[model samples]
Target: MVVLFLATSFFCVGQAAKDRFKDWAQTPPMGWNSWDCYGPTVQEHEVKANADYMASHLKDYGWDYVVVDIRWFVENTKRHGYNQIDPRYVLDAYGRYMPATNRFPSASDGSGFKALADYVHQKGLKFGIHIMRGIPTEAVKRKLPIKGTDGITADQVYTTENQCKWLKDNYTIVADKPGAQEYYDSIFELYAEWGVDFVKIDDLSAPIYHEDEINLIRKAIDKCGRPIVLSTSPGATPVTAGPHVSEHANMWRMVNDVWDHWRHLDHLIGVSQDWFSYIKPGTWPDCDMIPLGRLSIRGERGDDRMTSLTKDEQYTLMTFFTIFRSPLMFGGDLPSNDDFTLSLLTNKEVLKMHAESSQVRSLYYDEDKTAITSKNENEDWTYLALFNLSDSAPSDVWVNLSDMGMEGPVKISNMWTNEVLGTVKGKFTQNLAPHASGLYKIEKD
Candidate 1:
């Protein structure tokens, strides 16, 4: 896919709904998702515990959301992967997937996620849910009535074309079919009732670019009467469809599931570089989650343990994500975070750069090294990110101050450590450990 570097309008015709809620995510959203630790079987208590952790610790530094990831409606979820074999799904009379009360016990009364959402909201944080993009196949089989429709139903509006292959839960909603928009509208309407603050819709981006359904969902959200942040996932989100997704979704994945490994982190450097131009205030190109702290307790990929990434590499993970201004969704179990991991999330200076910096762009990229730069329009300092892509040996990464729109003597301080690394002129260089990175602020002295 060809990456286009263009600054275009995020809105198109028939986007009256988008115009109102477009400002909901003015900066990259920082939150915690349950998928990294609990897979699909995250219990209501687990969700509340994470929320409690976020509220007590991370909320002051902008980490607010506590999201329940995929398969909340599955009554029997398995670990190490999905419960593809005899997975029991729960659906409401209206055919909307409801939280499996066996898993989310608060929904035993059929309140769905309302009680959990209220629990999260009471913590001064937000709540989000993961959903597959389409109508539940069971809903179609049951021929459930599409809410707010004149006897229209789920089976009438869905199509088998381009249906999600890996997960057999839902059928793709036909863009122009009758009740299609209502199907989406009804779901978001339910989410609004549950007081959902964010929704990450999967199978709607990448390999199959579901722009029409995205529009339907966008319209659904606009009509829901809530400022729900929309996120599209499992990307490499067809680089050419940037503007369309930008208009409809607040955070669309730029790469597939990024694991806690060196290569995965290495791969995102390029994806972020390719998506650099699209980093506007409201629309962010997500680079997946931060698989740090304690991960894979009962996750889809691995056995229970902390992340496999080493300390230096973890810094690169935080450094690049912050400077690139991608949404920081911590994928680990928050309550289990160690002192070192907690330190990564609490640094005010690094997060300030993530939230405030503008004009973010790659200064250069190559096999051995990569450099990225940004500026806060409100401040005089220029922020820079330098990474050593090399795996084994220490390497020197270099960039010219002139390229960063700076010249002459300038004081450079490490944003992570806040240690002044002295002054430099037009040419500057920093030696980084293998797989390590650095964040610095350059200001004219």
Candidate 2:
């Protein structure tokens, strides 16, 4: 009877936590993440540089979150390589990972990420960090005491049987154990104290789909008394689990790490189609980061270079994501953005399609062309994205007004070029370059 009472109380607390922060993430989050450019070795200076760039250039256009992705706790992570085998992760007494002072010097003197997060907040941006979905294996080995759980230790709450296939630094937490929830609670408490605004939990989403750990993390996020947006990573989050994920997380990835490849962009069409109905105001289906501008500077893929995607393909990438209302996280080196990339990222109309439009979905697709459409809630405009998926030739992409449930004689304007394409009745068509797209805004004439 006592155990049942405790379980009920815990459930109530979790519910309360979610209710308190329901207003967060009202729009798809736009931001920059460190992984695509710097991989596991992103340092304080690098993060600050991007934050500085965003504040100066991108902040006005709603690009705000600055996330430092994986392996921030390691001492000397090689460029393009995660230091999973290194037993030198920085951890607090209670077994929570801390930013390595060697990388984030501001975290020195037991301050954790408070100073860096404060700097980001001062610059009018939110701060986020990446974490693997488990207690550190090193902590369990040392039998560290789980904070907030009297006499319970790390090993007691961990199960070695469910380890991450790629990263061996942490052990999956046994959710039913006495100390498991307490440990997650403690880590989030520290994050709250440090003023973290977002957290991306890895190995808990698609492919692995650690639902139990996701719940524990959600509970911890709520109990911490902060409104941190919870994101789950490395997805293809099962379409069947959409409702469960929406209940627990603000955003969940719909595909694996999206990079500068045409095939990657092509795959997103089907992925978006499957997950379109699941998108809501606070919950989003993430398309992963946009790998444009200068990428792989010192990271996993290669040395510094502009995105391999052609200019037209880049537009298609942005068009697809915005129309689908997927969270946009710029994953390139910010300071190195060329005018073309800058224009793409800052186009207010395209951004509005993402932030204000609803009823977004693919209208039509074929062997050569694909078309998607959405309606703006705040305005009478309808957004249309026509893509030429063909590699060898330009293709004519068409959208019928009747299929869109709209009547004849519509005014259409190319969103990218800002050119009015003249009034059209019945249907509108645009010839797009190979591997390119045309985004148009349609209104009744």
Candidate 3:
């Protein structure tokens, strides 16, 4: 895969749908997704409970979208397939997926999700669903009747090569095909009528092919006459396609399923440094989610143990994620949360840096093992985030104001605690808490 970092100035053609993305995901969406936390086993009741919790607690901080992840089909719901039950329950004869009857009995009239979404909306929240990026395998095998705008079939709109790996079935939509737009338009139309505000299309980057189908999906959302925020998943959304995808997608994942582990965070941090340039307002580079607190489900294959990170390490991770402007999606179950976790998620000061700052860059670092310093652009005071990822070292990192295109003594204030520390010379240094961070505001004094 060729990864290219285009300068932010390069203009990509095609306007985003209905200007829906105008402010759709300006500060990176913060919400709950079922896949990472609950896997394919999430029932409608469990989802409603989670949504209820999010509405009551996390809404004040802007965590609104409640997404129902994969395996919602009826054919995939059968007990024999392990994870692949009846795909029919997830999707239906009309090519529309609804909540399973066993899980959501009200869905027999194609109104299960309709009721759920209504409830979510009544609570001042949004509803979303996930879908693999291809025609159903069963649909293709049975040559199911298609619902094309021009009376064409879905089979005519897609090809077999776009199938997802690790899954037994699904054909990728041929975005360039004659009826592709009409086919995509059909799905979004169903969703729009059902009141969906977000849709995550998966298997999108398998072998990372097809910019045409991507464009078609974007177009479908627009024609639906609804503002559906589109998110592409399991991104290794190649950097070569970054510029184009940034414009079309409100937010996209930057890695495979992120679990609650140290190595995952370590790897994600390194990969994101190269993505800083793509951190514009509407488009965000997602680092999966905060897998801390209480996550007890599949894909979260850890000791249902409490987060192993020390306070310092947790702060360091949160600081890096917030300053880098990654979407602050929490993966832990919201209904049962500790005060410590809530405090971290609801910190207004930390979130302010993520929402407001436009420019972020690495300012200084000694040997890679010792320390690293990052800078954020704040109109009033320049913000600095210093972290030490090393296991055994107390990182001593410094920043020189003059070198950063600034002058004079720098007055510093802690961004987290809001304590104004005294002034420093052109060069100022801080001893980092091991596996921790020091987020500071520097002003010209």
Winning model by lDDT = 1
Two-way lDDT contest, 2 vs 3, winner: 2
- What do the candidate models score in CA lDDT, each in turn? 0.90, 0.89, 0.71
Which lDDT tens digits does candidate 3 get at residues 164-258? 76665477777677766776777788888889988888777536745777788877887888878888887667787788788778877777766
Task: Give the higher-TM-score candidate: 1 or 3.
Answer: 1
Tell me how far the alpha carbon of residue 46 in candidate 3 is from the true structure, in angstroms, after superposition. 2.3
Model 3 collision count:
20
Give the clash count for each candidate.
0, 0, 20
**lDDT by residue for model 1 (1-445), tens:** 1233222232433354345566899999999999999888799989999999999999999999988999999999988888787888899888999999988888877899999999999999999999999999899988999988899988899889898988989999888988988888899999999999999999988788988888899889988988999999989898899988888789899888999988988888877777988998889999899999898888898899999999998999999889999999999999999999999999999999999999999988987799999998788879998999997899889898889877689999998889999988988888989998889998889
For every candidate structure, what is the RMSD over all alpha carbons to the true structure, in angstroms?
Answer: 4.9, 3.9, 5.8
lDDT digits (tens) for residues 1-445 of candidate 2: 9999999999999776555554689899999999999998899999999999999999999999999999899987887667665547899899999999988999998899999999999999999999999999889999999999889989899888779888898998999999999999999999999999999989888577888998899889988988999989988898888988998898999889888999998887766778878888889999999999999888887788899998888988988888888888999999999899999999988887888998887787776788888898679888888889888987778878888888779999989788999999997878888988888999989
- The estimated TM-scores of all candidates read 0.96, 0.95, 0.87
Higher-TM-score candidate of 1 and 2: 1
Q: Residue 381's C-alpha lDDT in candidate 1?
A: 78
Please identify model 1 stretches exceeding 4 Å from their true place.
1-17
**Candidate 1: count of backbone clashes, pairs at least 3 residues apart or interchain:** 0
Instruction: Record all residue pairs in model 1 with backbone atoms less than 3 Å apart, i.e. clashing.
Output: none
Candidate 2: 10-residue stretch with minimal lDDT: 14-23
